[model samples]
Target: MTQAAYEHNGRSVERAAFYAIACDPRRSIAVEACAGAGKTWMLVSRILRALLEGSLAKDGHGVQAHEILAITFTKKAAGEMRQRLNEWLVEFAQAPPEKLAAELLARGVPPAQIAAQAPALQNLYPQLLASARPVQIRTFHSWFAALLRTAPLAVLQDLGLPANYSLLEDDTEAITAVWARFYATVVDSPSARADFEALVAVHGRFQAHKALGAALNKRVEFVLADAQGVVDASVPPFDAQFPAFAGLAAPEDLLWAQRPLLQEAAGNLGRASAVTFSAAGSALEQALTAHDADAVLAALLTQKGTARKFGEKIVGIATVRAAQELALQVAQAQLQHAAWAHQQRMARLTRVLIAELASLKYERGWVDMNDVERAASVMLSDPVLSGWVQERLDAKVKHLLIDEFQDTSPLQWQALHAWLSGYAGAAGAPSVFIVGDPKQS
Candidate 1:
């Protein structure tokens, strides 16, 4: 069918060609319709066309009522869709072809096409009603939950749990309890004690506690990389990994050998290197005074990069340049290891916390919404279980309709994509129909 343009208030408005696209029942359609632009009417019409045309059927009279899955974001929206679908079925069951044709024509369908399909629609409604055991209209979460319930054994197997678990109504108490357990252990455990000491040494006790608390909150969303086994308790140690700063020429060796300006720069560097109170600072200071290139390099390595105020002793142009250079090196070093201990501690702590949290939930046969999605995602990712799921759904669902597509999470999408794309028969794979407004998503 060709695209149609009609007059709307005072201007020409191009009518959406959704009827033609949706009527084909061969390809998927994703519509981003504005509010009050007949999105519901269009979707209902598309679903009705799929039913009347018997296009979703593999080798039968037509697709069953339960074969069409329509998912919306809200329970209210799902109710409305189910209600409207029921109304459409009833209307076709009772109305004559001419009347049905008139209604289709009003909805922008071609006259001849509507007349041809109206009779079939009238004939198909009774069977559709008879076969409607469970209406497949549901909110996204409810649908995913239903999928888990459908394949409980497969879900448990895929997640490697002993049996199916009950979902917790709320995770607040569970989270707090698990956190308390981890906190108590960390306060007394040997490894945790060492981490705490190191962290305190670098950032002080009060600052360390604040920093650790912040890191804990942030680590909740951190997924372990594949290489880092999920149960890996150890974090990479910073001290062992820090490059050994040895066998290097001093800063003066590189800059002092050039000219008067270079020698002045070296002198300034020497003065800047001597300002800190650390052993490295003292060694760097001695080496600078004695002009020992190798010793200066060694001391620079040991220096933790602290700065001091030197009122008028630092004055020359080269001296200023040398001070900036020193400050940059010191500042870079400090920034690099500023939270080295905290990070290592947090990584170890987070892994333990996550493991403990899972253990607590599993021991109690409880899971949260996130756990629900995770299990569902695992089921979809598994070849055997995913195939089984797809086979079951393929026989029941032929068209996938989603409302509020923009609000779909990655895991939710993964579950849906797996089922829809994994249908066994190649000839009649389910078509996806999505509608939403980006502005309101």
Candidate 2:
């Protein structure tokens, strides 16, 4: 065989071996594969195996159609998976014995057991069609919405949501309206106006609006971070000290005091290393003469705040070396302070924006996907409500297959973890199959 063909066949065999283990119904598994690696095919294969083996079901008579839940990242993916699974079942039911045996073997059933598996494979189509509750294949949002429907009215009231709240698929108009109201309120309130002005001064009006919009889009993440105490709003103080320039309170003052010495050193280095030092020397001279601290630091250090090379000719000059080191330290400290200040501003702005948006949503009786996820998480975590929710979910689903798992948000994972935590090692515990490609994510 050609080398390329041989290598391709080798990979095929390896993937088949992996499928054998990953598709086993008795074991819960997680698989990460690159795009075009047949993740959908593997997911479908696992479902079929679980149904045929019946080991994952509490009743031990094979998993029913209603007992299996498949969650996908997008609606189109969920649709595609459902279509593929149905097509496979139809094909399996009609194929002749030999064809059925080949299909079974290809799906990871042992060759010795293919004949014994044929009857169950043929029966799956009719079984699914007769099921009172068809298998649920839904996007994460869709599944969460369905779960929320089962929540008690008292719980919904606790979440500040109406009994029949409408899902806002597109929240653009609502967000724009909230922003206008927020801007008006900020103008009317002196304290809020000051914060707005500071934010606008740092980022300019357009960028400031854009930053706030981005923060609103990631409100869920901010809420989770705040709850975990991972976000610190206090601005970090710039405390870098330079012993070489002890009395100089500012970088510009230090540069001005050492102007004569720096100019002489730069002149010498420029003459020795014209290609590397000439441009920096000229810029340094101009900045020092201008008495601009930021410009002087930029000339003395690289963009990453590292001191520029001064060449062998100027290395032995102690005073010049100390000045360069001091400039680098000042640049580093200034950068840190600026970053911390920006983060604090963004955090403060985001908090206000989220509050305004929440009020708007509440007033309109609207809930977005983020709200759905949060509500679901709250329901799953509540000590009293969780037991009730678990009982309902346990009766309906015994196997979970999550596709595009890498794209799942932290909040979604938290809810799933809370819901599944108690089932570990318990009687009739559900089996989970997760597959995704991190590279794709």
Q: Pick the candidate with the highest lDDT.
A: 2
Q: Write the per-residue lDDT of candidate 1 for residues 239-269, one digit (tens) a residue.
A: 3333332222332333234334434544554
Query: Which candidate comes out best when scored by TM-score?
Result: 2
Compared with the true structure, all predictions reach lDDT values of: 0.61, 0.76
In candidate 1, stretches whose alpha carbon ends up further than 4 angstroms from where it belongs are 1-13, 22-24, 35-38, 55-61, 91-99, 106-109, 122-125, 150-162, 193-221, 224-266, 269-323, 339-344, 392-394, 418-425
Q: What's the C-alpha lDDT at position 120 in model 2?
A: 79
Name every residue pair that clashes in candidate 1. none
- Candidate 2: give the clashing pairs: 54-62
User: What 10-residue stretch in candidate 2 is worst by lDDT?
Assistant: 1-10
Candidate 2: where are CA atoms >4 Å away? 1-16, 55-61, 152-160, 233-235, 239-331, 381-384
Candidate 2 C-alpha error for residue 383, in Å: 5.9
Q: What digit string (tens of lDDT, one per residue) describes model 2 on residues 265-381?
A: 556554555566777767767776777777778777778778776765554446556668768767765666667767876777788888888888888888888888988988877
Q: What is the lDDT of residue 261 in candidate 2?
A: 70
